[model samples]
Target chain A: MQGKAVVPATRRRRPSSPDGLVLLLLAVPGIAWFSVFAYGPMAGLVVAFKDFNVRDGIFGSPWNGFANFRYFLTSGDAVTIIVNTLFLNALFLSASLLAGLILALMLNEIRGSLYRRFMQSTIFFPYFVSPIVISIMLQVILSGVGGSGGALNNLLSVIDLPQLSWYTEPGAWPWILTIVKVWQLGGYTSVIFLAAITAISEEVYEAAAIDGASRARMALSITTPLLLPTLGVLLVLGVGRIFFGDFATIYAIVQDNGILFPTTDVIDTYVFRSLRTIGDFGTTAAIGLFQSVVGFFFVTAAVLVQRRFHKESSIL
Target chain B: MSTTGYNESLLDHEAREADKPAARRRARRRPEPFTVASHIVVTLFGLFCLIPLWMIIAGSFTDETVLARQGYSLFPNPFSLAAYELLFSGQSLLNGYVASLFITLVGTILSVSSTASLAWVIARRLPWISRPLTVFAYVPMLFHGGLVPLYLLVTQVLSLSNSWFAVILPILLAPFLVFITVSFFRQLPEEILDAARIDGAGELRIFFQIVLPLSKPILAVLGLFYAVTYWNEWFMALLFVSDPDKYPLQLILQNLIANVTNATSLPGATAAQAAAPVYQLRFAMTVLTVGPILLAYPFAQRFFVKGITLGATKG
Candidate 1:
């Protein structure tokens, strides 16, 4: 029966059948949507060069050549904004990566499944919560005018420590923002690393144990080394995205707080502020274009490096 | 019970072997000091994550005057329901909930269906379309036109501004979800697909009858993901939608916070209204917006873990 089925299956396996057309039809909606939304916007990047006027439209707008790009690059705030975006993202990436790795390692050491599950679920709760909601929560916990007077300040007063004005303080924002980023994302990212760690075969650990290796030694030497590839891929992706500031977190937490703008303002917020406040479509578009171009190159470089080091792990 | 007995016997055998002089060193089974340390660390971290949420919930229940005087507390001093009352009493809050529900439901359905369809097509390895479609899917992941152009396409070209479509359409076919689903579909036993094909089922028929039924777990996982994303979505609405009536729950909450903050700054009659324990109201709003999804999370937690593991390992 199996032999007969195989013969028929071989006969039915035609290459250029009408089923190809059917599959193509199935792909149409997605392809069309991507073209209009993804690639269409990509082509619309040309508007960065053009003077984008509402009356003349994206294409019909008069060409401004490099004026938009030139203006953005030369603007006094450009260097500061770019630096702030990179610095903040780097801080977030390194802090979250370290925290996530440490947490995953600790979680893996846990013996009871139920306790581990509870801990993971609790930690992942914030990842699902909207940043907008977090911003509100942060206000209740940090705002100076609150009844409970931002929780931290209240705690400080109780301890006889001076209360710091978190919202208005520029120098404090980078640390505060990084902590918030880690708080929101650390557990979620740890889950990814934990998944990777769990995928490591139990046989390796058993062998290491038989060799008289302590659990801590085994984890440090065996597990951490094995997790490096996963960590490398994640880190590479993080470095590639160093140019992109988390717009939602920054926007919500430091909305129009000009006093804190020195540390808090990033390329995303700057561009958004420009578009909203100045309505300079060309300059903002240029800024957006700059970010996309640099981001694309970095991502490509990371993929290339991944391919070189771990051929099987290359995302591209 | 049977499994535990078998494991004990296996352990006895291993121990007996370890006792032999010829045998090599055996692994220790006792819990180490590090295990206790690990528990303490994890518990501390867990508390760190849970405390903020606890504080918000407690603060929401605290009376306005008490909250004003004492600050946020782990336990409410003079508990009251006024914050919740204010939230539910307003027509905007109810309207925001309606808008959010409609968007999350409709958006998830549309997104999952389209993603599954595209993924199925790509996963099948159809003669001419598979390779190109795969590359097409990835191009968007690597490079995007950035916000300015995307905003232009949505507002100018598509003219979806201020409409729910603006919120729904741009996110309907996320590249990440599509790729994840594609990898999942690709892992489905090819032999079954071959059998279905030999049974004279067309592509669509096989997909609808056999493939989709086999794909419920992944589809459910993706649906939950999309639903959460849509529920949490406010940024797109901030950019595109200007009408107050069209605001989603997140945007409404954001506006409420912004209005309160803005109102308090100005020296006017509105400042008095803004001074009505806005922190407590904000906390209440936070609970209202995030409560349902957080509640739903535990139920979906198993599938979320499974889906992510599959995607991570395969991708």
Candidate 2:
């Protein structure tokens, strides 16, 4: 039966006809999914411009014509949330990049397989668990008098210093969140840089070595200079996402803790609270639409910049 | 410049270590200040990653009173399984496990297959459909209808408030992964595909029999990415799932941790709150939730590393 089928197919041999249709058939489910889930919600973005009510559907709702946008813009929460998002993402972005580059350079210098692998594995271990797990685990160490003095407090008291409430202090969270982001993503990012460094060809290092360049000096002069493009690309990509925040990390760790919201809350968490808790769709969608439009411009600019830098690298 | 630079270097390093005189290598390598400092710094960073997790395990074993007093020591003083006892005493944990497991398994399979099928279409770049399809997929990556509509669509319109479909369907296809997989597929030996076509094999047969078999590494990596994502799905559950029994492990962990924090942070907490073993239970819950991912890390490490590097550092 297979042989006979093959014989007929061979005789027919229509290159694009059979494959194209079957391929389209294969793609129907995904297209439908994207349409309903992705584009459907996109069309429903009209809620940003409407006084949305659950009863009157998204389209049936009265068009408010920038009232939602105006309300959000005038509302004091706009500047705070937008500033918080940019500031926090900026902290995470720079810290992770620096941490990743340093770790990568260090890892690259180590030729011993076992120790390097062990360190790589250990550093990368944090990526496996969610920030919720990390935050909970570290809470034991970071807690203060209000929550039963944790390890840091214990150490501080031993040193005749004051025990600080880590969680309640909004001032400490920006640095705390930055540290956590580095700890979680540092290893993963380092591995990427290491891959780039590995492809730098042993000849470059050997040639520098014969020229009497020290390892540290070579790393500074040779490796760091070579990493500029990657660093720049990552920076541009990070800029594109400046309006977004690590909602998962923030929400998981902070979890409706109103005390930390002033510093830790970003546009994402704000929108989430509005949609879920406050039940304010019009204002929330207005904020969402704002983020989307601004985010689209940033992304487009990033792609354009990337295309100018390396034509083949642009997503567009 | 092969993409397997890290793996190849690792193998090369191992072989060198095996054959070379370690005593000689160490003697030469010992005096370098740079090497010494890097070893110390990287080693400390490694310990920094492991210590908190280790402390949590130790804290889970410690008695609640001891934990409160000492703030989590390396060895559990007056070790007690009270947290374990409390954890196993409920059916909710089991339900969390079941829900998480089912979703991760089913969701990863569906996501990966959908991604692969769509990715193959994009990779083929047929004149008529591929470009439009590509735009349809990629546009969502940049701008999407915001959370209000997504929530309303899932909850009110689709009425999937408590269904697993609500969570899985939203994230079923990632354009980023589709693009990466498309790139991977496009690099295949086209001559083999051409030969198969000339020999009267249907495109479907060629894809199933040859292309997919050849695409295992990328698929495995992509599947691992999806599985990790599905396993860590808490945000969607927060949005859609309300039934405690249906909660994923992450949502359970989030709620459990939140409750514990609330309980502990109360001013002049009642005796019942103090005696509840909240500290140990918190750590214990974290351990249970993270246990599987940690266990799978060693096996999945290469694939995970490959997937990220492939996606992020590509030209």
- lDDT of candidate model 2 versus the reference: 0.80
- For every candidate, the chain B TM-score is 0.86, 0.87
Predicted structure 1: lDDT: 0.79
Residue B220, candidate 2: Cα error in Å is 0.9
Kindly report the docking quality category of candidate 2. Answer: acceptable
* Residues forming the 10-long window of minimal summed lDDT in candidate 1 chain B: B17-26
Q: Please, what are the lDDT tens digits per residue for candidate 2 over residues A1-97?
A: 1232333333323345656888887788889889998899888898999998889988899999999999989999889889999999999999999
How would the docking of model 1 be graded? acceptable
**Model 1 chain A, poorest ten-residue lDDT window?**
A1-10
TM-score of 2: 0.92
lDDT of 2 by residue, B111-177 (tens): 9988998888878878787888889888998898888989889988899998877778888888888
The local distance difference test score of each candidate is 0.79, 0.80
Clashing pairs in 1: A147-B67, A147-B68, A147-B71, A148-B71, A148-B72, A149-B71
Q: What is candidate 2's DockQ?
A: 0.48
| Collision count of model 1 | 6
Off by over 4 Å in 2: A1-14, A144-146, B1-30, B261-274
Chain A TM-scores, candidates in order: 0.92, 0.92
